[model samples]
Target: PALRSIVNPDDARFLNPPDMPKAIQAFCRETRQPAPRTEGELVRCAYESLALKYREVLGWLEELTGNCIEVIHIVGGGSQSAILNQFTADACQRPVVAGPVEATAMGNLLVQVRASGELATLAEMREVIRKSSKVAVFKPGPAAAWEDAATRFAGLRRGN
Candidate 1:
């Protein structure tokens, strides 16, 4: 919010075309906005920007596949960040299912189990994961703000 007040929220962009810190500084310089000086601002900017990128990629997927993705299931360590999960839900206007922070380890164990012929198929592994894991669901909130943010991100990506 403080950062928004300092610059046109409409000018916000995802800062990943370059590496993180450099991209953020470059973007701030290009937009004539002050660079984020505090850890909170930097973290907020990165999280929000990532959420916008996720929305963009999801849109591309829907366009290319002719399928509507209703929910985003985020497994792995990244799913542990509730802030990111909420931001993703807001940005994508979709419910986000986040859990199994140890997804990689779980999958490795499952693969071994499957190789041993205890698990029959991928579906069986998924069922076991579902039964054993606890997941949190984040529902999309009011989307007007995120819609505006997305527009800004899109414009930035296009070098507008």
Candidate 2:
């Protein structure tokens, strides 16, 4: 079934949109997939798709930067999920360091501090965050099958 919650069912952004999780549920219903009522399923779909997109985008970034960047820092509420974090590490085939869950809040506060002449650049802000926040590191699991999932997800997108 076609996904129902958006003007374009092809756009995966409708799934677990940042603003409203309800809209995401509706998006699932549109596709005849089970509405992910539990936090785990909801986050699972969002994180899995996000990891795929991150890998895809990272490839584009690599092309643009002409460098193979292999580390990612995931900070925020979404980063709290060990399952999702490991999944991202696996999907991207890179080590991911996650934590400082209050990133958004910290960023906002940092901006305020900088604007008040208490800081200089984003680097300084990040230094402060490094001091203030706890971090957790994640390494890609032994799931070589994640590579297959990435291919399967791509196939799903292409309808092959």
Candidate number with greatest TM-score:
1
lDDT tens digits, residue span 1-160, model 2? 1111112224656655765467667655755556767666666666676677777778889999999987888889978988778877887888999988988888888999999999988899889988988988888876666676567556556644
RMSD to the hidden true structure, all candidates? 4.2, 6.1
Counting clashing residue pairs in each candidate, in order, gives 0, 1
Candidate 1: Cα lDDT at 147: 82
lDDT of 2 at 151: 71
List TM-scores for all candidates, in order: 0.84, 0.68
lDDT of 1 by residue, 39-89 (tens): 777778778877888998999999999999999999998999999899899
Task: Report the CA-based lDDT of candidate 2 relative to the real structure.
Answer: 0.71
For model 1, the stretches where C-alpha displacement exceeds 4 angstroms are 2-23
Candidate 2: list runs displaced more than 4 Å. 1-47
Model 2, 94: alpha-carbon shift in Å? Answer: 0.8
